[model samples]
Target chain A: MKNRNIPKKLQDNLITIGIVVVCYILVMILSATGLLSNLLQGLLVPLCAYIILAVSLNLTVGILGELSLGHAGFMCVGAFTSAFFSKCMENTITFAPVRFFLALLIGGLCAALIGFLIGMPVLRLKGDYLAIVTLAFGEIIKNIMNVLFIGRDSHGFHFSMKDSLSLGLEEGGDVIINGAQGITGTPKDSNFTIGVILIVLTLLIVLNLINSRDGRAIMSIRDNLIASESIGIHITKYKLMAFTISAALAGIAGVLYSHNLNSLMATPKNFGYNMSIMILVFVVLGGIGNIRGSVIAAVILTLLPELLRGLNDYRMLIYSIVLIVMMLYNWAPNMIALRKKAANRFGRKKEVA
Target chain B: MALLEVKNLSISFGGLRAVDDFNVSIEKGQLYGLIGPNGAGKTTVFNLLTGVYQPDEGFIHLDGEDITRLKTIEINQAGIARTFQNIRLFKELSVLDNVKVGLHNKYHYSTVEGLLRLPRYFQMEKKMDERAMELLKVFDLDGEADYLASNLPYGKQRKLEIARALATDPKLLLLDEPAAGMNPNETKELMETIRFVRDHFDMTILLIEHDMKLVAGICEELTVLNFGKILTQGKTSDVLHDPEVITAYLGE
Candidate 1:
């Protein structure tokens, strides 16, 4: 009976897609064993991260039309929470088989809780005020992680550069998080399988939410707040919903991030407001309301700096030029102006002939 | 029982007293008009009642409970829906989606339910779609449901605005200038739609209309404001003829 019904559920999206995904996995496995490309290996993890961050952040900035410069705070929260849980439970006999899933859930819930708390008071403040407040909150989080001393080890607080390096925070002493070095020894459990599965699941959940009635209401509020209220929509409710969901997705990204890194940072000074803004940049460059644009923007932005390495001493200069060119193209009023000019020139030649 | 009652209501925008001790009582299933020259505080009164601004001096009652200081959304939830003087549809969304947004209040599903598209969610969504369709059909807009609100011609946009307002199932509908840019024939149809909705929903309407012909045709009762005060009010026939209302509001 189960076999008979397998084909029914296996229609187009659910089962057939799984087969394709498995086939792709097999190919990736074979390639990794043979002559794999460093470009491919280096691009994989970051591409996964960008896919999550860009799409999740789009829910806030595009769907809700609220500018936020602190998304990485939520991601950090999820990462730390999940990393801590898994580390503490690593050797526990009871916490086996589903340890990783449980950590991810805890991390997501923690991030979501923080999101709900922050969204309540801050979303009322509009535009720059909201941006500044969220940015400040992110900074505060980074500082707290830096200064909060957990315990003293045999040498001192066990928070030394060498220990940190051993945990993979840095290659040398300049890891930037000295006393409050990044958490380490977080089990590196994320692979292409888990990462790809997560990205697909997030896509399904987010796509469904955006197409549903609540998504429409949030978009309505984003378009016109006064009109939405007049139509009896509880504006804050939907805003909070978007905030919480976006935070949870960021949390999931964090979980994947910490697991892949093995060593975690209890306090991530680098993953602060600047990181959030970078994510926002991807969303805007991609086009706010288009999810496809967001994902593509994430991938391009993640790989662009790496690809620009061949620029040598002038890599940043060349990179900035490329960015400027892309932005100019983005804002150009007539995308087909060059085509039109060429056509006009060719027409004059034909007329003369 | 009165549908709406405002007792000694007043609003002060710091130094400016926008609405000063305004009072009005409207009955259920009645068509009422609030008329004034530009800046007579007519729209201010609507804003105050709708909780855009809380009146400093009086109490407002909808049905029986005093709703003088409720939030805009709460007031709307209490069965008061309104349209803007400037058209404010969700411009990017389609007409049906805009109306469906208004139908959000009737829906009772969690965000998870919405995201997961549970069977129950689909059932509720189907019901909402049917209701939104019915509302559009009533306004002869079922055909244009998929068209973006901003793309609609001026008259059809006005109709869509009202259709969206009705989707909320309001007991009292406030329409602030429902006929600003409509042509004569479109205006005639809008006038019929207004009356039809009034009768169909047994609605209590408070409209801030500039069209005298529209006010005279449909309104059984009217209140005219001049200099932030009600100049004259009675049956539309009586108020239109009032010297103060005509000179101060209805123009020369």
Candidate 2:
């Protein structure tokens, strides 16, 4: 791995260093001024949510090789749970930042637990079938929340800005998410700093996992389940592990999403079918099994429709066409030709070395 | 103790009998061969032994313990490892990574260690890498360790598949077709490698090979199967020449 490979090694190291420097510059720009709120609201929040969405979905579509059409459902769980707690705790305690973060983590953990419960039995069904099962799971969760009574009615609590800044588990905060009106008058605490930190931490963890022996086992199972099984892999166990972890990450994203919005809606239709499909499009439109691709794709997709807002409804039609073109490009013989060329170069090196 | 003992084993899909009251035992440290034409229920026997399919009526003893209804992973953890007949390499993974997959059961560190990047994870990971390299060295695949499994020359991919199965440190290695697509020279070399692996691992081997010469040259004992029945059993010389075995297989 060494001795004869210094130049290649240097090139790789420089590329990694370049990425870090770029990320650092971006973070500084976002965090240094009053621009933090704009960054947090406009880009950072959605970026964090999408990264969590893409990475967690990797466990289903990438690791487990199952198609799940209800990832947003898990996000909805994290969002409402975190929102509920954030609302409940406001003004009742001091240093609410720590509690707020804890609430988010708790939301994630709860979502992960639900994922494990759903993944264990339904993972037996794969591909399109698995997707439908997950869709149903999401629907079931949403419906349960839809009819349940958790928070107080609107007439019960009055929320104020000064009181919100002193946010804690207050005896009375506010009840605003009253059937489609949405939770209003919630505190805006999350910033670009937190979003960037989370995105970086997530990338680091996911990259390391992909490079580990266990990660290799997971990827192998994804590629060929039967082949993996014959070699003594516990398919069900690995599938469950991947599914559980993916769900947990999705939960974390949900927390970020709920807190940033400051409103909680337990409505199942909010997450619904399209959200899952959009996330799937993000992962595949980028590249399956490639972390960098997923991240880049998430950022691009999140920004795409927003960037083209001036075009209005026609923008969406053009976006669909672009997507179609991208998928179709995969069919070109030249793309496959390039694949073989890379393969030949590597193969030749094996012979020479 | 015998490596594998299938006593009065039978399985049926509705009414079509897949394996019918088949009984056989493979001894420790012996190279045994199972040879039959297509549809002789040879792969079915493998499935039953490896816990792919549960027998409706039979007892499977590995090292004298009944493993009649164990899950595939439990069976593997109990020291029975196998390679599929069709090449089943993890196509997208690097060659070395593919082999390291078999070492998962042996690596007992917690997932938390990996997530946290603890010092213990580095130690275990290094050890895994070393062992994976060692296996690659044995098969002359160390040079191609980083190449994707699918990118390996076809013959090397097959060998990589076997290396992966061996990574489990099994007491009994079941090879579905260890020499399926080899040139004559490659097949001859494979015979030596088979012998080397058996001796080096100090393990019993049960192989399903279509090539009669390879089976005759390497196997110490042979079981001839026909239409889900044990047609004959003995040394390669005796069994290959048995009147019933020849007629049942060749229609002679």
Candidate 3:
């Protein structure tokens, strides 16, 4: 077991990387063969973004054992921040990649700042109350973004809440954000490759955290709070650590998402309670605290509707049925017993053969 | 100086004095016991000492440093570690991982070092793993190191919790009803384990137990409590034979 442990650590990381590489290659192969339709190919970046969101959300929901309904809010912060930065940099930065990297940095930092601020008061509340506070925060951020107005001029930046027109600017000044309308004319710089890279980075940060001493402290708090505290685990520090990192990763997803589109909106419908719940569903279906499960569940669920396009009216019906069945298979006692029996039978047959 | 000294410690929940004017002075390397019947506040005193609940009025000095109002984790870092009345292992984690959690603060690697998998992170982690295995070996749990802590049998789980607490390298250890559900044989073994921990670690131990037989064999000094106040404190045998202590355990 001594030497085996080293390879075991590598193996854990390899599986996530392997899944990403395999998916990327498979998509490329399909595209090369003309088997992948234009619409499906277009879905790749968004799919990767959601995979990051789901995996990061698992850090909070599954590993940290906290119910966070404001994930969409953090994503919204990142999306708007990055989009605004890209809009401002459109004429100045000739290289698209450099501009996108800057956007990502600003977006991640802004989201982490907001996460730290929000987590302070919100983390004090537990369970349902925490969930409600975060839900309310998401809605608040969305509404705030709707009315916010900012534009750049020779005199510097101006901001107001009334309307975009309120940011009276010099002629030819860039209108970075239009109230309720969100950011427009942003470059479509996000691509499948960047999305995959960000996903891998997110996996690296999260998996490494889980294998570190900090990760142990965070999980211990989840497993047994009193005992963890007794062992000198500072509950607040570790909780905020996971929460902030989770927010930062979601911010990365947001940057990827905003750059994928020519225009982005912080609409309530896009970053609201429902969006939060959807991400939570991804984490739950993936199996709480299971990173590999999160990646697989996110991919399958994200692609389910497209895969069931032939079913049309029954697409959602089939999706719901699949979800229920998957949950039962993962959790139901009789199903578990049946699975064990099948495995045993297969083992005996292999032995006899 | 005594390793742990508590004076005039008092706490009230609503109107009831859960632990009133509790006092104990435990010297370094001593094995002490606190015993009483149900609702006698044995656990409450442990809670106060560990800073789970701040005393309404009192002072607690550990190694001559004041720690009365310190937070729970701070007290732990200040050289006090405890196990729960109900075993509180990280149920889903492997046994080795459970002990490693206790070794968390002992390492100095930054979060960035951990995230980037820096050499310092691996060095410290390997050391922690080796140490965790040693602790498990002491408890005869090394064979089951990879098994989930919840999957362990009851006696083994109890032993694992103690092994985990010991991983903190505490100067003072608190065991709250360590033999609560153990049978006679298991309880006897627990007695020897406690003795081994005290002798080998050279640390002060304060435990609460219902089994007088177990306490008498190991604890050199004992205190009996009734209704949140100490009824008697003396040699283990004398405390057990006291008339007031008998009445507290039995009836009026």
Q: Which lDDT tens digits does candidate 2 get at residues A57-85?
A: 87678655778888988887777777666
Q: Report residue A54 deviation for candidate 3 (angstroms).
A: 0.4
Candidate 2 Cα misplacement greater than 4 A, ranges: A1-21, A30-41, A139-149, A153-177, A262-270, A331-353
TM-score of 1: 0.86
DockQ of each: 0.50, 0.52, 0.58
Model 3 misplaced regions, further than 4 Å = A1-6, A310-353
The candidate, 1 or 3, that scores higher on lDDT is: 3
Cα lDDT, model 3, residue A299: 90
lDDT for A321 (candidate 1): 69
Worst 10 residues of 2 chain A by lDDT: A1-10
Ranking by lDDT: 3, 1, 2
In model 1, state the lDDT of residue B27.
95
Number of colliding residue pairs in each model: 5, 9, 0
CA shift at B17, candidate 1, in angstroms? 1.9
lDDT by residue (A129-162, candidate 1, tens digit) is 6678778777777666655433233333224333
Please give the TM-score for the first chain of candidate 2.
0.78
lDDT of 1 at B72: 94
